[model samples]
Target: MKNVFTTLLLFSCLISAPSITAADERVKIIPDVVYGHKFGMALTFDVFQPEKPNGAGVLFMVSGGWYSRWTDPQNMLSWFKPLLDEGFTVFCVRHGSSPKFKIPEVVEDVRRSVRFIRLHAKDYGVDPSRLGVWGGSAGGHLSLVLGTTSDKGKPEAKDKVLQESDRVAAVAAYYPPTDLREFVDEKSPYYQRFPALQFDKELADDFSPLLQVTPDDPPTLLIHGDQDKLVPISHSENIMQQFKEKKVPVELLVIENAAHGFRGDDQTRASQAVVKWFQKHLAKQAD
Candidate 1:
């Protein structure tokens, strides 16, 4: 009788397991959709649309160490499958790489991408007001900038896309450098790496998301490893403090003993946290 009960329980559990449907798959991929032209180079993005969408979209900034590069959409499809599983559309946003474009120019490119996405939200089957952004390292820094900066559209702009606000509804980033001015000392590698930003306090502050936090900024989630040698955990801590002071919705997760880029279970945990954050913040709320 006991053996029979165990067999029945196992069968029940197997039957209850979630089945993979066609709607759970990423069915559409639109590559190299040009969002802007800069320095005679085209700024493009790739959209990964799920077979079943939740009316929300996420923009993933494809940047690392201040250098932006093109990434194969298939390579990132697995990394973003969690978001896809939840029926969220994903966009891989690419900006002009550094050394040729500089940080400020990269910032503008990202902002423009956000505006472009918002302008065409309906065509993409996403709610314009329900967009989120996420990234790691330099991409994370740019994501924070999108969270904090809000601009009224220019009425005279030639492109209608430029007239949409660049603001994002939610943000999630991993180990981002929030303050450029804080790392301007002679001993800091970031100071030497980006020489163009040195001695320019105004420009540094302009790019610093820590300095840009406002009361009306979008909800934000930051995840950083406690033992991160490249971008310290204090970066997120300081920014979290600013977010609190300004009454912005923010949360910081510090992964114990993890490094700059999370590995093993730490990476999984960070990714899961990001998925939940967007799920909560990007949901369409009643007015």
Candidate 2:
């Protein structure tokens, strides 16, 4: 009887599944476009462009917990629909995963990816100067890095892409660790968790966005949960303060009673905030 019931349920689900067609999908996607080559691997990104673009682009950092992974654009359609609906082209940027490539190398890969995007912005129908970045957690750290550590391209580099600025005009991140060394000390629990990071002042400062903020850094919006334990709220608080001191445009939205990742209505609110942020900072006129 148990087997018969399970078989019937599976059959019902199969028949009840909604039939989806190409026309039903609103956004158009170009998948697995190689943006950079490193470590004998082709670093790629999936691009999702709205039916009508707003002439701006967003590099959505595809990372979490400091371990990089690729997410199918279809799987993230709902999560990114808000941006697409607002007419922004979204690039799902993937980097070399950690434990294989250390955090610093992953940072370099992300920087290279941004340069590639800016170099080919015309082909992607985006204004190179109006690009933005968005991510959370480890991805958020990289997003903050892109915002703060951007520099003029090496004019002498043989690769033309390397000669394009990696700077972005806007950034939005959620619950990101802005400082690494501050989290890992002799008495901290995270000291054992991020062994690859190597708790030293120089390396920490290299990876910590808090140490890199400048007045030229892009307009940034940070949404962090007050109750986040994995990455303390202080990380966002400290960076936001630093941005303020530098006279950079920044905002922090603290979600009350929320943890590392916002849930339910808080998550929805966070997503909405990201859209509004990019709209303000990445607008065509802002460029």
Candidate 3:
């Protein structure tokens, strides 16, 4: 059941899954652009530029259960049409897969991807400071991590990418596990399935977005199904509290009666909420 829900959640990342049409021509795609390298393998992301761009970028973390799978870029057109129609350059970023990379390395891989994008923002016709992020489940956890824990670049780093800040203007995370401390318990159910969570217990706090929030963290929107059993709604509720306490702009949209991954009208509503949240926070920056 867990595995089934994981697949369902990933497939439903699309915003209402619209059918592709000739209008797809309005979006130009640059596929497999390498961001970094790890263990001799290239880390990559695809860029989708709408003809009339808003000059802001929204990176969708391509992850499910910490596994970053690859599929035909063309198939993603309808999945991201809502954002593309809004003139946002959408970046579909894939990190190193889990069970091999683990959460610590996976987190760093995504951080590097953001830095790489920011370093070359001008070439992509985007403003580095006007970036936002979105994802679900494990991807959502990563998005929150980036939102709350992003840092200034290391001035002495020899790698140019390492010298670029990874901050984003806003974040939208769906059904994310904000606090990873539960995985630290050896007997916890998540520890057996998500090898990505099999990291040092002491480092759990470092990766948990709930523990990383700061007052300056970007405005965030969290969406979760009230009935989600895989990752309980409590995850979002708990972090929502922290965001409120810190006075960071935040909103939690709970979809009543929905499960791990939304279906039918629930998915559509969640999708619209995310699009609206990004527009509210990122549009001003684009202007």
Top-TM-score candidate index: 3
Candidate 3 residues 146-225, lDDT tens each?
A: 99999998879999999999999999998998999997668887887778888898999999999998999999999999
Clashing pairs in 1: none
Please list all clashing residue pairs in model 3, or write none if there are none.
none
List, residue by residue over 218-246, the lDDT tens digit for candidate 2: 99999998987677899999999999999
Residues 107-205 of candidate 1: C-alpha lDDT, one tens digit per residue? 889999999999999989999999999988778988998888768667689999778899899999988889887666667656666533455555778
RMSD of each: 11.0, 7.5, 1.9
Residue ranges of candidate 3 with Cα displaced over 4 Å = 1-18, 285-287
Off by over 4 Å in 2: 1-24, 183-188, 199-201
The TM-score, computed over Cα atoms with residue i paired to residue i, of candidate 3 is 0.95
Residue 130 lDDT in candidate 1: 95
Query: What are the runs in model 1 whose C-alpha is more than 4 Å off?
Result: 1-25, 184-187, 194-201
Task: Give the TM-score of each candidate.
Answer: 0.88, 0.88, 0.95
Candidate 2 C-alpha error for residue 231, in Å: 0.7
lDDT of each: 0.81, 0.81, 0.89
